[model samples]
Target: MTTLPPDETSQAATPAIDEPLERLARFAFDWADTLCDPDHGCGPYHRAWSMIRLLTKNSALPAGGAFIADGLHRAASGGRCRVLLAGAADTGLVALVLNALRAQEIEPEIVLADRCATTIEQNRLFARHLGMRFELHRCDISALTCRPVDAVVMHSFLNFLPVPARQAMIDALSRALRPGGLLIAHQRLDVGRRKHDPQPIKENRALLESAARARGYPDPLARAIGAAGADFWSNTFAHAPTPEAEFLVLLANAGFNLISLSRPLAAATNSPLFIAGQSRETPQAAILAERMPPR
Candidate 1:
């Protein structure tokens, strides 16, 4: 566990590091593009928008507005916070959160890290347009060293990871934050009615195949299913849904004292997962030590 030195000065430009993790991150971005395109039926960007709308309809604010408001409140309470916008696939949620922070008069030094080069570039362009400065890192969350941050956010990105990977990522994030720092995450967590059933990889493939057919893709549904199956086994299948208990345990292990968990007003039953916690203590060293023995 080598720790990177923290950026001390407010508004200082933090330099980006080019490492193996960064390269892998670039690869992930490229891979993600295939699935995220609007043409693709399962584009996470579109899915996230749908989820957001379902969550915050009651409030005058938009779907992700509550999350932004929560973060802003936390930053206001803590003062001059260093925030990490982890897995900022697209800039939609990040923009909302940043806007909320700005509204509260909190000068947040934001670090935007993600695996997608296109998204990173887009975010960079967007930030420039807004006259804002952010440190961009192209690296996987697991590969990142646990530097102290006042808060961390993962908007609609955690569900993409497998169960073990999600836990590992969360643990890493917990380590990255300073004591009492906030961890804001939004994802769909219900195993659906098929909780015991394995992720309907085959079913999802069928859906993709049907989508391809409807779109009149050159490839037949069988071929598309086969290709998607290959991709799933090779890449996406490793990630699993984090059970609610597991998620809570991971937070506790990471040293986060649960502050709040909100259910979406529009579709609380359908949307089983929501914002989890704002940690109040450093994660218990012993629990982490037991789970991850020193290499």
Candidate 2:
């Protein structure tokens, strides 16, 4: 267990503003203008993503860019690697992950697994259009039976699960990785402490707008986020944010070494990328090793 110094802040926030804008602009261009509706309690849940952008333009870690390509490239060295993107919402992020892998010339058997049927269908089209090939598994991640892999990538998916389910998912992920495998997740670290509804609409809008501005969002987009705030809180997530320490404990107990935790974007959850690895001593590692196909 690596003892990391305390993080500078723990407040959770969404992904940098550009990702949603880009996705919407490209795929749902018609709705791009009003994606953030003022009537909604300010869309706290809508498009409130928090993950490092893998593309080079926003590759700065704290500037809403991802740093996983290098880590993953190193991990995937030696041979072809199996990678899982659990709870894959759409193929948008998957495209970026693919770019990273391709950049390293790492031949990966990529699995985009999620439970939503509609999402799966949509992703098929998205994947085909992007000319990327991957296997799509449509089921809850906790229920997946999979080959052990070198790495798994997640974003804002675990926090919505109930505690028990979340734990099971972690266990399942542990079983799905080889010894020394990495689980890189971008998660919300402070949502549990957020104030729920009963707060007036005006106040909520003001709060959302403030957050948007703090992260340097333009006035129009900031106002749109404020507009969607209410809907975001009510409909977006199923569970409160998990404190970083608690989540780290869960990772540790599950036999993972905490390699890094970094907040690359601004959002309510301090959406930090957690890079964790399976250790040889963990019970899951022992079981997984036997089940793993010969390297």
Candidate 3:
């Protein structure tokens, strides 16, 4: 019934960016990351992440509304829907995903599965604001143990997994779905990037600091946040990239039948709702798959 928080979206963009929502989501994620990440986060790291994410997320940020809503319609034959969100960095994505369900006028029974308590809690608050029916459980995707649901939705979530963990994560997602259940996702592709590879660190602290400063953050705050974000980003790039073919293979291996794998094209569906935040850094494809009946 709502799109992403209006502030995180651009009215000009397909899914208007909601600035205030983005700010709150960034801070929540940074706080969670500092607490849960291997880097052992501190106050500085949290602040840095909040600033860094807001500036840098432009490339990989857009999670559209229409594609998701369409997928739900296709997967569900006119009834209340049950959805599982595998993992998300912030509530921004959650709001965008839920907005799709809202637009369809479906009151979804939603479950959020994540390892971060703060991230889960933030979404809980947002869901409550809308009076949605939802539940939160703290768990890792690779070892997901939730009841089978009608659909599992993810946004740019594949590459976040470390290469070794990708297989387990995919399998877990499959397991989380019921027979004929759907998996709807949009993921970025890095051509020819292989398993076990790590994405090279592209931006340094100086660059992030410069970006933050340009966004009107003060000198000390900008530099500190930039440094923290730089280090945090470096530590989290274990999944270098996923080639298109490789990603398809993972889906197939998980017992999913491809429904559609598309780009945001003029004549194709969901184009109006897709706000492409993916630049050269994170070109994306929309994927909808179904868990087929067992042989």
| Candidates' C-alpha lDDT | 0.48, 0.51, 0.62
* Stretches > 4 Å off in candidate 3: 1-30, 39-61, 190-223, 229-238, 265-281
> Compared to the true structure, candidate 1 yields what TM-score?
0.55
lDDT tens digits by residue: candidate 1, 119-215: 5665665567667777887767877774577777765566667566776777778777766667776543544212212344444445444544554
- Per-model TM against the reference: 0.55, 0.58, 0.70
The best candidate in terms of lDDT:
3
| lDDT tens digits by residue: candidate 2, 10-86 | 22123321234234322322232244344422223323322112211132222111344545664684857678877
Instruction: Locate the minimum summed-lDDT window of 10 residues in model 1.
Output: 280-289
Off by over 4 Å in 1: 1-62, 77-79, 192-239, 267-295
Indicate the residue-level lDDT of 240 in model 3: 67
Q: Per-residue alpha-carbon lDDT of model 3 for 169-233, expressed as tens digits?
A: 99999998998999998676664222221223334456666777887878987776655654554
Candidate 2 Cα errors over 4 Å, as ranges: 1-65, 192-236, 263-295
Best by TM-score: 3
What lDDT would candidate 3 get against the real structure? 0.62
